[model samples]
Target: MKPARFFTPENLQIVKRLVSRYPPGQERASLVPLLDLAQRQHGTWIPPSAMQEIGNTTNLSFEQVFAIVLAYPTSFQWRPCAPQLRICDSWMCCQKAKQRDNGIFEAAQSIASQYGVEVKTTSCLGACYGAPAFWFNDKIHTDATKETIKEIISKEFT
Candidate 1:
């Protein structure tokens, strides 16, 4: 709640570089980078107070951070029990492998839920070549199958 007080020298350097990227009066354009740094430092979603700190650093106000928070999906607070899974359910994946695509979703949910991990579906992970892909945290799984999905969740979550 108190902005975590966990700022590291590396984070400061990153934010400083980001701020320097914009023109003199347009430092606010660094909102994306600042939010990214906040998320990386916080190890999850950006807390509201952290957003305020971002505002302080970027010469913006908390209200501005609030607006950006809603605009960016990455800034939202992670839901309860969610493993933060982002499955690709795009048309290309569905066209190439609908059965496996559907199976991957079901398998991930079922297996992950057993370990209290939440499974989420997304339209695309931008890996069309894989036909079916998913992102678990920062890791990517390509051409995922139901059995593979189960194994992945089992190994990662439990």
Candidate 2:
């Protein structure tokens, strides 16, 4: 049976382009990228329907596609969450927080809670030199301050 299509026409074209990047027998290699694109298109989550479409396009079963998703929980979300703050939990970030005694993670969590923003701690945001870092609304803040976080969240939520 034909899988239910989830991607819009433009996204479907992008998906085809992504798949084409792999050789004929290696289309499955595009699964992760496809999932990322699907999540971005869906505004933060890959719904089951999108997964089904990805599986169909990649010649994988739904279970197979889901297994890949399960392996990378941080990369894929099953539900939509906006106004997100992703704190870096790398060793450097942790140490920087400790040194500053400002608790970037704790402070961000507190501020995000007040503003109804979702907060998560993910792997390195690739700003070790800056030490403390977090991503909010698609922008990464390095050497972050609690006041800055509060200000940004207030502006975004209120």
Candidate 3:
């Protein structure tokens, strides 16, 4: 990927705080958080230089940082268009009031048609406590019903 351009000063400040969360001798542990911040700032998969910057800042090798990005779904390396909607397909979500029956699929198709949005399925959002949750862009909608899901698009999609 090309070097991303959205690593603004404000974002750097946030990264600085996250980096400080780790002990002084364990800066390498902050790689995931730094990558997360970078993805959030750039709104897509990380640019190589951003990964490199993470490595350089944390005293980790470039390869080590690159591996972390590859492993996390939290990485946002693409523009949010026909955007990725990871509907929870895990068992907990299926048992919820807003179960992932055909309705979920139908609504996803309809929304994708209406707003040109794209839908995807992820195993779990780590929000099993809030099963039937939906991920739009980087935000989570918990206890979502079909109408609620529709409302999410109507309210957020332009």
Order of the predicted models by TM-score, top scorer first: 3, 2, 1
Model 1 per-residue lDDT tens digits across residues 1-158: 55454457888888889899989889899988788778778777888878877888778999988888888675355433355677877987767667544667777777777877667777778898887888885677888887777787778755
Off by over 4 Å in 2: 1-3, 20-29, 40-48, 59-61, 80-82
Residue range with the least summed lDDT across 10 consecutive positions in model 2: 74-83
Best by lDDT: 2
Q: What does the lDDT come to for candidate 1?
A: 0.76
Can you give the TM-score per candidate against the true fold?
0.66, 0.71, 0.79
Could you arrange the candidates by lDDT from highest to lowest?
Answer: 2, 1, 3
TM-score of 2: 0.71
Name every residue pair that clashes in candidate 2.
none
Q: How well does model 2 score by local distance difference test?
A: 0.87
Q: Estimate, for each residue in 45-147, the C-alpha lDDT of model 3 and write its tens digit.
A: 7888788888877998888888777766455445454466778878888788444453675676687668767787778888878777788867888876778
Which pairs, if any, clash in model 3?
44-76, 44-77, 44-78, 45-76, 45-77, 45-78, 82-118
Give the Å shift of residue 87 in candidate 2: 1.5
Error of 2 at 147 (Å): 3.8
lDDT preference between candidates 1 and 3, better one: 1
Model 2 lDDT tens row, 32-56: 8899999988987689999889988
